[model samples]
Target chain A: AQSVAQPEDQVNVAEGNPLTVKCTYSVSGNPYLFWYVQYPNRGLQFLLKYITGDNLVKGSYGFEAEFNKSQTSFHLKKPSALVSDSALYFCAVENGNKLVFGAGTILRVKS
Target chain B: EAGVVQSPRYKIIEKKQPVAFWCNPISGHNTLYWYLQNLGQGPELLIRYENEEAVDDSQLPKDRFSAERLKGVDSTLKIQPAELGDSAVYLCASSFGSGAYNEQFFGPGTRLTVL
Candidate 1:
């Protein structure tokens, strides 16, 4: 069985400051991780994915995530937060062709 | 470059009523998925399709729910005699490939409210 955990329900950040959203996972084999964002009443938009490459991955909208093998964590990060970044973020792990998602984290960026 | 499209942005029906939702995946995308998302929760996969074949539907409630993807382009999900617990957002997503690492593109979901 595969599962994902996002401990925080909400994360608050200030505009122009760095932000981090924590995510952890449990899987039998190697994990394929991904991050997605969902705005109000909108569908989830893919941010980044970690398949089999560098630990640090860059994605759309100046977003990035670091994959920690030892810690079994994949945390989304942004260098400078923007009000537009306020949304719901989800971390997922792919088992076979199925993706299991975490509960999600609400990100609020204050301008 | 049209993304996945879904209809009936919002639907409200009394308990025991039937409802259906539709989805059209991105052009030439063979894999399609339907997910259910409750308030403040992550989306859970209800079913998955590869072309015209339903490759996965283990999580789907076959007792009251049914789905089909005829012609392998457009798909429909139906629930007969919906229950109050059925209220949630139904989302459709598609990926370019059937590979494990394929990134999925999502559709603006249909919000269903069962009264």
Candidate 2:
């Protein structure tokens, strides 16, 4: 079964600081990794995906993720975090036709 | 293009009561999905539909949970005699196709509270 692990439950960072939310995945074959962000009372918004090629994938809202094959990690990162960027982030791996998701990491950006 | 839409943003029901949630996927989307998200947890797949056909329902609790996407556009998920454990955020998502490369658009979700 394909699965994703987000080690951090919550990450706190000051505004304008760089931020990273770690995620590691396990799959039998090549992994299709994705990142989604959910704001309060809102649906999850797609951030980025790492399907093939390009170790570093850029996504919406000045977000990017590095897909490290040997490390089996797809970590979400931003150069300068915004206070509005605070939300719950989820990492997912495509398993056949379905997607397996991580527990999610809460991002708290303090101004 | 509008995003996926779900109805009844919040609901409070007693255990054993019946509840139903509705969803309307994005226009032109042929694949729809239903997912359950518990507190502090990620969304889990409950059922998936491909053009009005249920292609995947392995994770759905068929004993009490049921869902249908008619006309391959709108969907409804129902729970008969709901259990306390069934309290969670029910999310609806849709994509142009059911492939790994296709990105899914999600709805705001319906939060169900089974007392």
Candidate 3:
């Protein structure tokens, strides 16, 4: 079955340090990958998506994700982490008509 | 443009009680979706509607859960005889033009707690 996996349950980073949240996907066809962030008690917010573009996709809140076709991974990254960036990050891949999401990874940026 | 709108930011009810949540998708968005989000997990799609038609509802528990988008606009999801395991966040999202591939706008979900 088509699925996405977020290997990390939580990622800790010092403020101003680079942060990475790992994600891997398995699907039948070329995938449409996306990243979303959810704050406490809030709905998921769209970050970025990789459809058919350059491998590097930029998104909201100063976040970006690299889509590696050979590796079947779309990992979210930020050049410099911020305390405010701490939240639940989700990776998703579009199946036929729905999005299959990973378990999620908590990104905690400490000051 | 206004984002997708949902009512009842939070709801708590005893088991066996019936509860309903409402959603109003962004204007001109014909694709609507309802998802169930368990604690510490990503939201899972329960049902999806293409205008007034229910295209994909295989994941929805038809015995106790039902949803409708009557005029192809606002929608409602009803759960009868709620159970403790049913407690979670119900999220509503909508995308313009098509489904899955387009950008989907989400609303603040209704947090449900079954006691």
> TM-scores for all candidates?
0.99, 0.98, 0.98
Worst 10 residues of 1 chain A by lDDT: A92-101
lDDT of 2 by residue, A1-111 (tens): 899999999999999999999999988899999999999999999999999998999999999999998999999999999999999999999998888899999999999
lDDT of 3: 0.93
**Residues B13-89, candidate 1, lDDT per residue (tens digit)?**
99999999999999999999999999999999999999999999999999999999989999999999899999999
Model 1 ranges with Cα > 4 A deviation = none
* Model 1 C-alpha lDDT per residue in residues A12-109, reported as the tens digit of each score: 99999999999999988788999999999889999999998799999999999999989999999999999999999999999879889999999999
> Weakest 10 consecutive residues, lDDT, candidate 2 chain B?
B96-105
Give the per-residue lDDT of model 3 (tens digit) for B37-89. Answer: 99888899999999999899999999999999999999999999899999999
lDDT string, candidate 2, B57-95, tens digits: 999999999998778789999999899999899999999
Off by over 4 Å in 2: none
TM-score of chain A of each: 0.98, 0.99, 0.98
Ranking 1 against 3 by TM-score, winner: 1
Ranking by DockQ: 2, 1, 3
Q: What is each candidate's DockQ, to 2 decimals?
A: 0.84, 0.85, 0.79
Q: Any residue pairs clashing in model 1, and if so which? A: none
In model 3, what is the error at residue A68, expressed in angstroms? Answer: 0.9
lDDT of candidates 1 onward, in order: 0.95, 0.95, 0.93
Docking class of 3: medium
